[model samples]
Target: MTTIQPTHRRGATRLTDAGRDIATMLWRDTIRTARQPEMLVFAVVMGVFFLVLFNYVFGGAIGAGAEVDYLQFLVPGVFVITALQGAQQSSMGLATDLAEGVTDRFRSLPMSQVAVIAGRTLADAFRNLVGLALVALLALVMGYRFDSATGAVAAILLATAVGFGFSWLGAAIAAKVRQPDMVGMLSMFWLFPLMLASTAFAPADSMPGWLQPFATYQPISVASDAVRGLCDGALDTGDLVLAVGWTVGLLAVFAPLSIRIYTETD
Candidate 1:
């Protein structure tokens, strides 16, 4: 058997080959999903369903003023929720690959081990971008509009980054646990309650008498609020700061945790 070797030149590690390998892994995963397509369809369907249901369901009762249309206000919420919900694919894919020994095969190859998770995370980020664009188009047809193009672009990019960060988190958990069902449940447990218990579906003030503070401070809330400002044409620094804070904090904690788990696992 011929060994696959990592090339080196003048004592400096040759990283171009590793980068190409990582890109190949990312492209292969994306192509696999393209061939199947059901998972992506499911995610898009769920996003559309929630956008229709909530924009009309609670829009009448919540009444946060019409400076921005209710659908517009709700769009940001949907975007955040959709990003969080879409994170499930990462964990599910990871768990399935781990169970089938695909990861082991990758480990035996002469490639950067971190590429396994990073490539998957990158592929999932692209998938979520498609989801976001589809959801936005649906919202537009439903009479939603944002006031600032720059802010809209910024918010979408930030939400996508948030999706990528959570993808790593989910992939890490799936790798360590090696169970698809458990990873699914654990991911939903964190996501669902975060959606309902926070200001995602309603204003922070409209939250229960006792849960207001928690809902206000939740990362999802911070993200939604920031996006809300952008949609409403009022870009406040506080919301932007809080949004970055949550993204950075989550990436800081979960990224390292996932890497450690990936290396130590199996």
Candidate 2:
């Protein structure tokens, strides 16, 4: 009689194998990102555009009205927006790969299937880190100061975490649609409403009363508030808690959903 592996041992082995596969996929994606330097340029350029435009064009009016240093308020919000852009890229990139049949090649390999999307999200996250750092440097040049080096690091990490969660949502969309153009449109469908309606570009109080509740409590607003607090050295526990909750909620819902959709896709 042939001996069978124990169930616990088999489970442990699969987990270990999955971890290795994820790492391998991560390396592969990272190398691909390096080869395509324009991807990085696009991410950084968008962040810079927001930084300059808001700081110059609307900064005077918003700053005067809010009675706060506009650049300081704007930078943290831009950090969150830049991170969201990375998530958007994650959606587009995966959709493009699917449209081009790269995932078909991945499916033929004897590896963890989920690693494909997992690795892409992780790679995009690293890209977000670099993009956020570049944005921060530019903010420094423009006279935006962080409360402390530690706070700055924390703020960036928080933004990246939120972005990572959203990437899973993007991945789910791509897996379901399997079309780059549609995925891009779908991403903007969700992204722009949250971005524009939230407190990222302006304070919640500036908005009409009916819109204030949604504007103040939405993910982007809470994220911006938490990040801004870190930058300003006036941390608000409520904002931080809400921001973390949103990230966790996003991952809990979308991570498995994306993996399921990818596996089920033709």
lDDT of candidate 2 over 128-214, digit per residue (tens): 999999999999999999999999999999999999989999999999998889998889899998888988899999899999999
Candidate 1 wrongly placed segments (more than 4 Å): 1-18, 64-68
Candidate 1 — number of clashing residue pairs? 0
Report lDDT (CA) for all predictions. 0.78, 0.93
lDDT of 2 at 3: 81
Maximum-lDDT candidate:
2
Task: Measure candidate 2: CA RMSD.
Answer: 2.4
Name the lDDT of candidate 2.
Answer: 0.93
Per-residue alpha-carbon lDDT of model 1 for 1-266, expressed as tens digits?
99876464543354776688789889888887788688778778888878888877777766555464567668888888788777777778878877886777887887777677777778878888888888888988888887877877777777777767677778778878878888888887777778788666778886677888889888888888887787668877797788888778777887778867877843
